[model samples]
Target chain A: MKLHNPITLLLSLTALLLSQQSIAAPVEYIFINLWDEYVQQTPLPDPHPDIERRFLHPDINIDKPSVDQFTALFPVYDGLKIDTHNQLAIRYGVRQTPYRLVVEGKKVITREALIKAPLAAHADQPAQDQTLQTLSGHPFDPTRPGAGFRVLFFSDSLCPFQHIPNCERRIAQNNHLSANIDYPVITVIKPFYVDHTQVSAYQQRFNVNHEIVFDSHNQLFRRFEVTDLPYWVVQNRQGKVIYRANQVPPLPL
Target chain B: METIMKTNLKTFLTGIVLLALSATASAKPYPPLQARTLADQPISSSGKITYLKFWATWCAYCVEEMPLLQQAFENSQESYQVIAVNVGFNQTVKGVKTYLNRYGYRFPTVFDASGSITRQYRVTGTPQHILLDASGKEIYRSALLTDELRQHLATLTGDKL
Candidate 1:
């Protein structure tokens, strides 16, 4: 057989590099159990039996891959069984499950965005600016440029049930972040026919270390389209919305 | 004198019947709650006003509301009973014990590991206060620590707080 030419060798090397790049792209399935009912109803549906049979079978002699690699190999349609009692979910700031996250490298692609458009279509957009007044009557603007990140926490003070626990968790998480990390958290009390007294009561109820503002005019709520109590929006230093969810985001450690 | 005795006897029987009827009307039976405490002692609600507080160690609001529950427990020693039911849905017995120990909370706590009792009571979150009257009928249920709850608890326990 004739020896391969230099051009042929270069072409083959380029093809091999391209294949490696494709394989190296991080595409992982992040399965999280958001509700107790889901865990009670296990074993969850095995959506990718072929993948499970090929990679997870006991007969396979392949070295057990790292958690990231194992998740990467998981089919997009499949769900993993996770213990609701586990602390790992809590550490990730996951309060409930059916919480699916499609992560490529360090970026998180929310299920809503993934369903609406392509993953690349979800881009960091500028957070809308709105006038806000603190409980002490100080003017606050969240969209103002700052050095570090700002967290806009929207909660209803008079909400007796869900928002209470959620706000308490947010306070604890914010305190932790404040002590360990450098970030400003602004808690906006969304107006729900609540007066200053109720707002004050809520403020005193939780050990809130951040500034508490009252959006009595529903400025931020309308601007952000927040229809739920105990919602959160995180903005980067450039005043761009980085993360928006009902649950408080884990400190970017 | 004979007529007077008859009248008194009639009054006494009427009072007895009324008392029995009142007791029957007020005391609706609650779902049987039988569970083991962290100390491995069985705790159950009896024919007294019961304050069933469903809580978990991981819940921040639950931890905050514990002191209030403890106060109510201390005050309501004679007139009623306070049982802190640990809704251990996503918690371990060991964790609950550690939390109770760490907080030095002495409120009688029972572990509902399977959440059956929680489901029966329709408890969705921690620090849920369900006040059952002396007849076992639920009188008050709230997840908030308010003046109304304090007053209701006070009336139930007959403690002037």
Candidate 2:
């Protein structure tokens, strides 16, 4: 006549909550500002008015290279990881001052785009699979349709700032994933500074023993809309994109 | 009575004119790009379909793709304008000119000394191609000479190449 055992029900509820948390990855807003020292401290034009109104508080200042300032401004957000060396800015390829982005679980959204549309509209967009020639001289399709979780790692061999801690850690994580049999990882090199011939050396240099594909013509970048380096996207067996972030996300349990 | 009717008609016409002006003003034009070329010539889109190629002197891919851009420039002569913008990343004006002269590539070049124009377009990498239609709306953007870019150019200018 009892509905359930109290101890068993409590454990079941905890497991249910943990499962939900993993499924719903945390959404973070990463704001990268060009340091004043990098460029002459000239009076810059005001950012887009909507940027001020929607994304930032009026009192929070930007364009200064100070960890204290960022920490003070973004005290509440867990995703506000400070990069004192401006490595994140370089990784995101920030050419302008005060670049802002919304990392909603897997999707990277721009400030203006996010303002115009709801996050749901930008969610679960499928990553496009292109036929690329792998280092082994075979046409490789990254989107292993109906396979287990496929890890697409976007790395740049010639990235000047690849030595940075965050970048190095991401590379190490990929290397570890490369050896793992559960995740079929493919390192997609940026075509800007990398050619197919250099792919082998990149592998040897970084000890990236996994499948390396040179994204020729940048079709994959355009299709996936990824502009940053050391990025990762994980797609499930059904080819449904579950997660994508600048840094590697944890593998689903 | 005739005078009164004429006054009302004049007021209605003014209202319509103001409405039309507001509509056009609200239709945002593309970001403005006005700069002097390395050869000291002023260049702007000037209501023409303009192609912007963001490149740096040190970028190897940019060096390799210059010839294709030169051909595109020569082919889309009257129908479109091509402006090669030096991204101004640790590059000097003299170095850019020397490189251009060495190659004998004569497309209009803008040395974005302060990276103002480059920042405006948010160009992250070199050899980035951006094509705008005559109306100044960006029609295409790519990192390489893709067939899609060629198709966009062909459709816009009726140029087979």
Candidate 3:
């Protein structure tokens, strides 16, 4: 069978793996990670209502700016010393991911990482779908089903990795701890791609008595701002936000 | 004479104990499900020894292990029957059949769509191996199958794995 561009898929999975391994520094278009897939949950119709514009007038693509030319992108740093997208590119040394220069009437404000293509602007107020049910699939209002220590699982019981004994043998080998007390596990599921049935079988068999919620339409994916499997957000039941675990070393038990 | 009878009875009980221990030393063989032929139907064998390997097209590790399994099958086809069970979650029947063809796999295959069988066997993952004797009794079940297992099969089939 003809395999679709193997290089691209490798690059993508590699990018995801790298993002999880690196330290917490704002990556340029770092959506290659787990929640990156969840970001896709938003259809063409529903976008992020919150006008969290990372850049202004990101449409104007200057010819691949030279390293020094990138200096013009981010004219400001730290305290907003007239942020320029050019200088920001130079600081970050970005030649691959398309970045934009944010300027306000010649006075540069800040350089922000630009999207590859124009993002569909839905920067409105956060209007969560009132249709979300609880983990039990019942109408969950007043009490936040999401307002607690969330445990994100990335298991397809169908996958042989399930037998890797992560749950069974509990190997003390190299572990990838997705959640921490500092960052509770805000569990997410893989999208319904080719192996969705695997996930369905897994959920039906594995989640014997555990609580779970599905992003069937990827709606919840947009809200919590997730895009990957096994990705989690650790928060408190008190509605206090904790550190979101991008990826951490697994705890050896 | 009464004392003599009691001593005789104790000796008989001791002999029975030794026999039971010897039987416990060896685990009995089991009979498992048969594999389907290239035509997608169950293929049976008389006094048959079967190795049912569960695998998928997407798994990298599973793919890596295939050539070794193929080698093992080639090593012993006459004495034992090797059945490859395709545990696929996605893809058309054509896609699966095409893959098997490309692999040049000659062993009979069985397709499980809903993965109900995978669940029934408590199989968490692959490459899983389930061995059966002639009567379809399950003998050995393991997730990490190795050459040692092949050697074990050789003993059951009275051939080399």
What's the i-RMS of each model?
Answer: 16.1, 16.3, 20.0
Q: Sort by TM-score, best first.
A: 1, 2, 3
Q: Per-residue error at A74 for model 3, in Å? A: 30
Model 2 over residues A203-248: C-alpha lDDT tens digits? 7878886788888666666556554457787878876678877666
Give model 2's docking category: incorrect
CAPRI rating of model 3? incorrect
Ranking by DockQ: 3, 2, 1
Off by over 4 Å in 1: A1-253, B1-28
Instruction: Give the candidate order by descending lDDT.
Output: 2, 1, 3
Q: Model 3: residues >4 Å from true position, as ranges?
A: A1-253, B1-38, B45-47, B157-161
Best by TM-score: 1
Q: Write the per-residue lDDT of candidate 3 for residues B1-161, one digit (tens) a residue.
A: 99999999999999899888867643443324544554668775436766778776544335545665686688664666777776643324676687678768766777755454554454545568777666655667655443347567768657743
Question: Against the true two-chain complex, what DockQ does each candidate achieve?
Answer: 0.01, 0.02, 0.03
TM-score of chain A of each: 0.44, 0.45, 0.31
Whole-model Cα lDDT per candidate? Answer: 0.60, 0.63, 0.45
